[model samples]
Target chain A: MVSLELKRVVVTGLGAITPLGNNVSQYWQNLLQGCSGVGPITLFDASQHNCQIAAEVKGFDPSDYLERKEAKRMDRFAQFAVCASLQAIADAGLEINEFNAERIGAIIGTGIGGLKVLEDQQEVYLTRGSDRVSPFFIPMMIGNMAAGLTAIHTGARGPNSCTVTACAAGANAVGEAFRLIRHGYAEAMICGGTEATITPLCVAGFAAARALSTRNHEPTRASRPFASDRDGFVMGEGAGILVLEELEHAQRRQAHVYAEIVGYGMTCDAYHMTTPIPGGKGATRAMELALKDAGLFPNQVSYINAHGTSTLANDVAETLAVKQALGIHAEKVAISATKSMTGHLLGGSGGIEAIATAMAVATDRIPPTINLEDPDPACDLDYVPQLCRRQQVDVALSNSFGFGGHNVTLAFKKLKG
Target chain B: MNKQEVLEKVKTIVAEQLGVAPERVTPEANFANDLGADSLDTVELVMAMEEAFKVEIPDDEAEKIVMVQQAVDYISQVAN
Candidate 1:
């Protein structure tokens, strides 16, 4: 094996257009307060669908962030990506001039890219003839358009790409960006995920698959991760982006470092497409690899951001994985599933949850998993349910598992002088 | 349609498509240089004008109609 010396990477900025809030501060506050963001499906007419509620990002006007003409041409997903990225770039206080433009990069991921746009355009073509379809349909519907548009908006001419690994896409994007900077590919990267898939077709598809919660009467209490009565995940839509820079580069600029990314672990189960391995063997291995990559023991970890989708299968599997990966220390770690509040952001979940994890490490406060009442016996770990906790977290791990058996774990630690 | 009527409609289309004030869209305003329209915006504007006027504008002809006055003149001629 070739020995590789990696550079330290730190998160300097965070931006989010989440179901919880439109910005990072608002999202963090709502997560800590145990507020649920799920509500009635108002984006479109969901009367015919079995699942009628979702965690939709409300009051997001693309014109507020982009030119009206520009906003009209891009899909909602791309709009969210550009808006969040611009916020992150501004938060970092790093100017991208001609000198440093080539050193900056962007990697934004999405699970289902522009599903609303595609569905709408297809309907237009079928009903109004092919010529009636808008010229911007292709650009609006492609998944990579988010990354492409973000580069156009920010003038980052360096490496640009998109990761499309279903739910794991966001974490994979951040992890890949960390590798890019760690291995000396780029000095700084604007990386995360964006998804606006709360459309008619998406809701219908998930509902048909029985993958969504049908608790329309009580939307706020629909997402109950780690609870015995949990049924399924509630679909959510939003974007989360972070500006990651090399430690030395951030130090030189006196950037406010939120947390240091010490490790990234990615693996594939190759067992099933939609369902995770029976006992989360792949997930357990990913966490172990992340711990090893950080050169830290499992006992060193203080908190965990779980991939708890409020689904019975996912919660039990994730619980088993944590126990197997951390051994006895799993019970000691304070784990929280912000998805309980934000709902399942799908591709965008990992990105926002990673930001939450970093903030927990930096602020020494862990957000709670809302609606986790009467926790299942299988999920016996400290889930930090119903209330936030104040603890000095030395290291925190965020986990993301996608539909295609893709498992990713990202490790963040409090910056030590 | 008369020249004045065509000019009024063209101005309205330009103002609506570009998200600009109606008063700002003068006959002399250029779609790109003055109205802040990129290449894609120009195409969309042409498409909108075609739909509004019920006229088929060829690509070469569309390229020639840059100014608001030029669009008004072209539409007036074709409409008559």
Candidate 2:
């Protein structure tokens, strides 16, 4: 067998602390049940703001997971990444002494890393003095701290980097991790995304840009992806991570395999910074190239975890992209936007959604796109609305489109015997 | 430390820290259940109490001091 065939990448573990739930089991359960995590903004006062709803991780306690000093040193985003990575590492059943340090890597992504730190430090500078700003400001604010801290804790000496392509970051990190194993760059990699940008500044910025929903009266129902009345995305926070291992390495170690990473495609919209191209041209190419990378035809794709952000534009553009890439098979494919339930976690969306896709492949269950009532005619597809469906999902595609026209798609498949 | 004085100070601090009304800070109120303090808030509150009174609170000790009275007594004993 060729090295590509011999050294396939597989997902050995999954972890997430999402708006919908605090862990993988809870998140997956809520996802299948179509439960909405969106609600009135609790992190800050939204009384004076246009957008008053967001999806916040309900019971997060960073100090519970990290030391007090460490927790103080890191901002919310880094804390989320560390927490999710801890779960992933434990789930993988990896022994610290089992593998060479150089053969293991860590890659975590953040769309807007440490926005909370930015806000806090700016406040300190304004209210107090520049000298009063915490000495850990820069370290806490940098996007790479998540991966760097993970590496420091676990002694993962291989390639470590943070992807910051806005929303596509999660998919980009996972895809890059898969390639690390494929190219023999690393035997195993811990990869995913974390984001905690549901702050006053972030919400105000999105609202100022007219990118967030103002459905304050009905917070739970505010995030209605693919619906005709959809207005804009609901800001969310949390982290999701996966343990990727080389097929041979996992087999030799008798590790559990959840699913296989079969394909990854990334492209640029080249159209706009904040808006996707007029018909999802970049998104279509991303999915097409992803299918090609998976060596699967359109018919082989059973489900799609759409990046349906509950915004008017993303839903239409993503629906058309699927149609363009998958042809007639797009109609047959069951499309579900887990974001409809979990809201958009920015960079963390792709990691958890990838886990959702792999779980759908592993468990033969497809999560539903909640709040799909009154769907727009433009986004007409089998959105797996209302309830979970038990269907044999051999392969699933997860799409993530970010700002700056970055588009990414990843393919996962059931592990073959 | 006068118990009433300690209780009043504790109530004020808990109310301010947890974002609740001072009258809501009763001896029977649970930090998480009645006072609306999440795990993080509780931890920070304990730290603040320690700094205010110049005392150390172990995690086990902090967990035991859930109510306003308990926290005030614990602080008074350690501080005195």
Candidate 3:
């Protein structure tokens, strides 16, 4: 076994443009209140689609975060990423001057980048001519533009890249950022995931795959994770970004530390593309690895932000994974599926969920899994049902499982001193 | 369109495409040096101008039209 010497990394700032709320404070407040962001799809005409409801970032005007021309040139995902990055930079109060500019980096993840832009450009190409397609189409539609634009916006001339691991992309990005800082690759990193795929093709494709909830009549209660009646995930669109800095660097700058990221573990099932292995072997190993990396036992984990996507297979498999990984301690951990309220933000889910986990570690409050009216027997874990729970939490784990059998678990611990 | 009409149209297109106020879009303003436009933004501005004027500016000529007045002159010469 290779002994690794890593620097300490801490999260100093959090930003979220989520369905629950626009910023971190509002998102956290709404999560504690168990608010649901799902509603009838107003982005486009979803009347014919089976899953018509979604958790869209309502009332988001790109002009609010960017100039009219800049907003026009970018896809919604990149817009959210830039907006969230700005918010996080401001919250961290770290001035990027000539001295430290090159030491800062950015890494953003997206499952599907600029799908809406692609769809619209394709339509323009078909109806008009190829030349009629906006010259901004290619840049706006590429997934890496979020990180590229974010670096340009923040003036961070350091490492810049994007991760595209389906739903696990966000967590993977954050985990990679943590490693970068911990390994002395950079002093600080802006990392997260952004996704805005609520387009005609995305909706139609998910509907065809039967991966979305069809509870069109009651939109608010659509994403019922770990519940017997849960049908499927409700699509959500947003971005979540965090400013991760080396502990000494953050301390030198006198930044406010939200929580210390202790460990990160990533594994692939290699079993299926869209489904987990029956026993969640890959997920269990990821959780075990994260705990080992953190130097903590299973009983030390007080809360879990589960990747309970409301799919029948995932919920049960995740429960089994947790049980296998934590044994009897699984019963004591307060696990909640925030997707029950925010719906599934796809790649954005891990970033936002990690924020939620950090906040839980900082504030000792666990958000509820709203709409879990009847628990599924196979998923027989304490899912911190419909009401928020207030309990002192020292260690928290956030899990994200993506398509292509990617599993990531991030462990965050409360600041000791 | 006449010179004055073309200038006005060019100003409007540049103002809208660059997210700058009409007053800021002076005839002497260089798109890259003055208006904070990157290469991609310049390309987009050219595309928007092409769509507005209904004239296809060749890539070689588009590269030459850097300033607002330059775009106006190119559009006026080609559009007719």
Candidate 4:
């Protein structure tokens, strides 16, 4: 008598539209080259503002991805989401027309959805009166449209939902997708996050709260994660999507398996709305939990994709959490903060970073964390600084923490076949 | 714009705004029923039509102007 094991889940596809690059390959190349996508804000006039730069998605023409009329109906955030999802679907070599539509699902997360649309409509309301607003306001401005539109576009009739956990939303969405496929709830899931909140109102709000970097004079050097001279995180806008499939299903289809998603851990700080816990207790526990769930020791993980938002408090707290979780092995892990190059993508950060981790394990190349000239005493980890390094990373982990103290950690391992 | 011109303009605006065929934006077609417009879309459509026709549509009148014909008549009265 043979007992069946629970089906494993692996990353079959990856897609991203980021400030660093519009596609995953370009993004990965930019990360290896240590290119800083952070620059002067060009989407709107930031001359009169204190926070004048952002990691804006440069030269994105939605017409390349969406239909003429469909483009008009969706906000930029949703457009990014759908476009990234399209790329992922194509990358996986999965044909929606050929598959059972009822078994496919979509789970997209967004931190601040459709802010551009909302703000624009608000201006029309104030100047031209409320009656002058567009008819697509609600659909274009809502956070859930990213997931909803993906389902509509792909004919996915299975479970469809979204997470709104700020920066952690992307990780949560992917982690939840893993469960959906592992537990026999679904055969495949298209999960990730999208965010295009780099509008004037979003910048102004973050600036008012003193949460964004004020180094407008040096936009490229502004996002210095884990550096002692770090001021604040730079805002960014983009989306990423990953196709997660059951292991057997992927093997049967002869799909390219990037990495196996082994475990996920989530926690809440319950301490502050905008600040992490003093000693990084929540993040530490999250890492520990994820390691335990994967049944692996800290020494097994050779790479880490740190959240490292370039904020003073977050960088220190994240480093502290790594030390607490990995102990003596913390120094051996090759850590890199992709946010150092892409800026803080908010909810979309975790999804894209997860892809980076999987790619690291798949390609045996660890990307670098740029702009770490003056390392902070508080962050003493071996952050693969300034230059990309080639390493045989068998296992990797990625962490994302959000406002309201939400924390998420994901673990990935190279396929052992 | 005359009544006929106003109707034609309203139909074109509604067709473009709602993403439907211009011929489908008839006087009797309901915004939600035939045009596939959700509630938020109706508001935006009114705004676009008002901008295109150079007229201000009152909320009270806007609420009653769901059909293309109703929008044309309302714009005709206000624009002139």
User: Candidate 3: global Cα-lDDT?
Assistant: 0.92
Total backbone collisions for each predicted model: 0, 0, 0, 5
> Which model, 2 or 3, shows the larger DockQ?
3
Q: How well is candidate 3 docked (DockQ)?
A: 0.71
- Cα lDDT computed for each candidate against the true fold: 0.92, 0.87, 0.92, 0.88
Highest DockQ scorer: 3
TM-score, model 2 to reference: 0.83
Off by over 4 Å in 2: A1-6, B1-80
Q: How many residue pairs of model 2 clash at the backbone?
A: 0
lDDT of 1 at A358: 94
Instruction: Give each prediction's DockQ, rounded to 2 decimals.
Output: 0.55, 0.04, 0.71, 0.48
Docking class for candidate 3:
medium
- TM-score for model 3? 0.96
Q: Give Cα distance to truth, residue A268, candidate 2, Å.
A: 0.7
> Model 3 over residues A147-175: C-alpha lDDT tens digits?
99999888998888999999999999999
Ordered by DockQ, highest first, the candidates read 3, 1, 4, 2
**lDDT for model 4, on a 0 to 1 scale?**
0.88
Show where candidate 1 strays beyond 4 Å: A1-4
True-structure RMSD, every candidate: 2.0, 8.6, 2.0, 3.3
User: What stretches of model 3 exceed 4 Å from their correct place?
Assistant: A1-4
RMSD of 1: 2.0
Name the regions of candidate 4 deviating beyond 4 angstroms: A1-5, A97-99, B2-43, B54-80
Poorest 10 consecutive residues of model 1 chain A by lDDT? A1-10
Q: Where does model 1 sit among the CAPRI classes?
A: medium
